[model samples]
Target: MLSFLEGHTSEVCACAWSPAGSILASGSGDSMARIWTIADVMSRSSLQNEHSSVVVLKHVKGKTNEKNKDVTTLDWNKFCSAPPASYPSGMGCASCGHVKFKAGSARHGVFRVEGRLLATGSYDGQARIWSTNGKLKSILNKHKGPIFSLKWSKKGDYILTGSVYKTAIVWDVKAEEWKQQFEFHSGPILDVDWRNNVSFATSSSDNMIYVCKFGESHPIKTFSGHQKVVLLFLFSFSSGKKGDMWVSAKHYFVWAKLTVSNGTPTGSLLASCSDDITAKIWSMKQDKYVHDLREHAKEIYTIRWSPTGPGTNNPNKQLLLASASFDTTVKLWDVDQGRLICSLNGHRGPVYSVAFGPNGEYLVSGSLDKSMHIWSLKECKIVKTYPGSGGIFEVCWNKEGNKIAASFADNTVCVLDFRM
Candidate 1:
């Protein structure tokens, strides 16, 4: 590790590398988010470091003794420019202006794809929008229960929030109002992801997934099969152009460009894992799953698709799916063949997170064993391992893939210089 960040007073639950990969953002149980500047340290020749700049973002109002003030999640916007002049009124707030947060902790934070605005959901049944520089922009106050997950559309025009009230709301970013509200989930919504700008999919504690569009009162499509609570969902595309893709709940969803003989687009595929110890791939054209991955002995915690294959940054590499499990192993899958390519068995504890480098040549996995391993995809072996002071909650590779930022249970964040 190049340096350790120690300002947070509690466990750091989440961390995200900025799109440019120069800045690192972390959310902690201390009711605060921190922006750490590490570009200078990364440029130095020496591996060891201590001094670095940090910006502390307080999420609570004036001093209080309330509990559960943690910042549960964090995300960085891809764009950094100011919003256009035609944006809705009352959407711009000063960077230093203080916005009061009620009696609950912030559960999730996501940035608009355009990169200028951030939206955060809290347990107080509200979602707040903020500028990139940490200004309060607007407050969304419609959900009656605590929010659990949220996401911004790819077009940067809308924000989707899922709440414990069993409802999901689509907020119009430009208009600063909710565009539509869907209340079809029978249980608390755990996670959500946008398949396109107009439609999205939601996973709930009811073991069901629903795909909803902007104006539709009912789900366009529903997926059910998991016998346990669905925790997270993601959409992966097959090509560079916008095309049909799949959505999965709890584990992950893989989307690929489906085309017909005439070159027109068809629907996409979806892959999902669950507490049931299996990850299944689904087809949009049919009701049955395409593949059922059942090698894990315990619950699968997370899944990530490699940024490779056709149309990605690493076009020459094969596209693969990675699943991290409580079974203390990370498995790489050949999504097209519906088979396991290799099993990463270096970590001694349950793997909590796995991330592929931007170049898609290496993969990083962090575990409860307090160790992070960097594996060479081609060799299917660990090339480097870094032991941490605490169990790691999350790990992410910067855009350049030369730096990695990890959040830990020890109330600290570590930035590892990968080039070393």
Candidate 2:
């Protein structure tokens, strides 16, 4: 089954599934974040009568029809489960408590895992926390330039914001204040991700990645090798065992595992990809790269580690890495062997995003060609194809792996039901 969500007046840049997979939130250039209720879609017997409800959470103030207040990025609170329909007021906002940020666009917004608080970073050089129901909780008024990226710790105790000012700040969630600020990057900070509750990593346009921990005055580990700006990175610690870490950075994608012995972090594994047409895997223990994957003909846009393999959700499946690129292809790499598994060649335009299903049996890729493809890992072929009306920016699968959501440049979001 397929459904098109049309409400945003401009491009829909970001969309995230609720932790429970009952709701989907999409951010748009229209300066609005919309919560869509899709619980009934799965039970409906007929596609002809399909209907879902949406709650528009306006990010702008005053004018009902405002412009330039683009909601650039948004993430759902990982710990929250109740949808907007369960809220008493159906997503109403408090007029007085909300802070009216400057007209600059909001670059990133994320929800803490424990509390229902949502943290949003803007070009106005400020970050604001909002309740899931649209009430402003607190305002983080620091940073000297636009915030390019922000992330909430898995424990939900701290929030990290990276800015073009070449600094990254860790904010105390409960205290609603800045705990520590790190001025380590020589260029604008592009992305930030938490490695653990207290330690995290940051990437910068200066072609470097820094790993820092709480209460530390400087970065504990500095990774330098990417020839171009590092766009983004993620730290995945799915395996409860020590010495298992996965990290990725744009232009460079790094998968690293922090080896812990008696509670002390010993070493890590890092993987990075770049516009230089190469992807390299580094070993923190050896302090050098162990594998260099050079197969793509164009600049790689994004890469993701599969949620399967050892220490992951599906331990029976081999660990794989998927990378999308401007060459209009998606390549899967064996993490253990550091070799190409297969190349998915279908899209006509540059592929922008790729995501693995929670079970790791399938992979999905979205491309600027205005299409999305769902491929079976075992068969290594496209099992399903979805044509879109606009260029696709992002694609993601819900936790249940039953629904896939894609954001497009045409100011719309599409959801594909994949129960079969």
Candidate 3:
């Protein structure tokens, strides 16, 4: 369940999975993107000569094999596609390793389009598409600044990306082109989410969340309350006939449902982190504050709900909630009762991201201290701390709940196998 790949000399920033769930795609600050198979990286002791960069010039008539081998004289096609599957694999131009890991000031972030299609945003102001099998699909060169975040819709037919240049765009998967451009915040768009095709929300350094519908040039509603720049915004869904719920964080954290239907949130319940060091839940429909759950002594950086329904023992009890903070701890809470359930500690630095594992029996978290920790719900303690690539900024759990993808501030991404 614990393994480390030291392929990136700098920081590994982003990690993603393929449709088949066998391969992992990672982007690094070394200006290289790599494809690692789960069996290859985990089962084997080493991958010798696997991270080669030699460009192979295949010939049809006569030529030397660039793979340190000599071959019969053959004719070579001067123009062929699919660059050599190198150490780090990501989208970049054919001539220069634009997507390869580089030194200072390079753009880096990775997102999955479909289950297999992967996209990377670079400081080079381009978004590159690739297949999960380590093949470059296309390069998007329309953006003028670093692409900070990228996401695919539920159906995987479209793409949404946020930029440091203060804008977010939606792309058409079929045409491989920009479909819509949304401009609202004056500062860089830090994060964005597409809510089941019904609506989308964006966070910004300008301390705002802009909600917009598809094809609309302007935001339908704007949520402004944070005193500092909003760093992340996430939307969640339930089975009932209601819209999506949104969770947003900045200097504060807030959650709300956009609209309401039949006493349920037709929209979403919105929540936010407060400078007061408490997380507040709000009713978007009622425009009234629900409850201010104050527990953390420091600022709450992140919050997430359990994937499972409310506890079976107390179906009427409020749902379970998890929150991380600068206090160097993560805490679980009963949102309905507004009481602390358990305190999870041991992180040395600020805990940036926390997530419930696939089985809900465990939780995973990433910390600025350069580690990912897997905690046991049964024991309510740190079970293990998986070393990180750089300063872990985010940790993502795939749909299957087997792999954990961690993004670092150093621009590298790491994938941890949870099989153990």
Candidate 4:
């Protein structure tokens, strides 16, 4: 068993690792985010001492009372101290007002591109950037409402920010400002991610996924196949220049991509996860359904292909697809053969977040139970569970896949040293 790492007063919202996997960065609802080094966490006594003065955890009845408590104390030089634009991790109001500046609530979520930087969306209606070493980078204060989600492009050059204010903005990270990338739906943007280069996709409370492209002012392709609001999405890759990929979801629907070669839409494929407790694949080219997978009794929330293994080189790899659901289990499927390989069960609460480790031998999941479970893929059993301060919202492993960083709903961040 490993000793747990702790330091955050409120719900921990976001966490990321430095490129070299030396330092971990986290954002929380306590109105502050922090960066911790590997050495800081490895030595339990050292980590506790350095983080002791950073957070003052008090069980308050109201969520908005965080500012009234000692958790608002910023760690001067040791923590986020940069001004609003400089990307300090501390919770400080950066809004400008003629009467009074509302700092808004603390952060709710965070995401990172690589080692050097990461992005966070806060209830204060802002998105801020930070260095993995715990330095503040920049602050964006344009969203009229709280930012719900933040995603970085694969290139790390740009980021997409979704807000409850009913709009999504693409930011040019290099320019240190907002870019007029595209306007999202009138509803609050729930999730967003880039698709390769030419296009990006966004989901909203309206239960729609808008496919957007560069230069266009509006969504070029509006995909409206899901009955419920889409929560998560990912794009599969193809090495061939002319081939296409697909995307899946919480409700029923898979989106297939078709490229134009001679000014013609060549192919299409689609997949759907329905309330009927079934998942199906579609042929976009034929505009019809192709196959159905009725493996689980509940809704599917997560689906991802194995970047390595059979999904890449071996034709046999194409048969593997990992899916997690409200059923409290994770099912590994042979997509090509359309059958189950294994069903992983351990978590007591809804498995809200899941990710495959770099080695593919371990799988990590965060749950509403306020804990993160690390499982051995080969053993198909829980190896360890790290308790957190609040409802565990997300868990992200550093580059080396040894240390895990987690975000909580109470505005706090927890760093776990697996080796411990």
TM for every model, in the order presented, reads 0.85, 0.83, 0.71, 0.70
Candidate 3, residue 255: Cα displacement in angstroms equals 11
Query: What Cα-based lDDT does every candidate model obtain?
Result: 0.72, 0.70, 0.59, 0.55
TM-score order, best first, reads 1, 2, 3, 4
lDDT, candidate 2, residue 171?
90
lDDT of 4 at 131: 49
Error of 1 at 87 (Å): 12
lDDT of 3 by residue, 193-302 (tens): 66545466777778677777886778877776566656655553322224334444442222322223554433364445544466655434433335566778887777
Q: Taking the tens digit of each residue's C-alpha lDDT, what string does model 1 give over 339-399? A: 9999999988999999999888899999999999999998999999989889999999988
Candidate 1 stretches with Cα past 4 Å from truth are: 42-51, 64-67, 79-114, 239-267
Candidate 3 stretches with Cα past 4 Å from truth are 40-114, 239-245, 250-293, 310-319, 335-339, 387-391, 405-420
Q: What is the lDDT of candidate 2?
A: 0.70
Summarize candidate 4's per-residue lDDT along 1-420 as a digit string, tens digits. 232346665556556565544566556666666665555344443434343223222223366644322211111112121233444333332221102122452432222223445566666666776544444577766778777667666545666777766787877766878876456676777666656445666666676667677678877666555565565554444212233434445422222223434433322223334344444443323332344566787777666444343223322223245566778777776544567788888877766667666555677888777778888766778888777646776676665777776666765555666652
Better of 3 and 4 by TM-score: 3
Candidate with the larger lDDT of 2 and 4: 2
Tens-place lDDT digits, model 2, residues 130-153:
665666677787898777777776
**What TM-score would candidate 3 get against the native?**
0.71
Q: Alpha carbon lDDT of residue 303, candidate 1?
A: 85
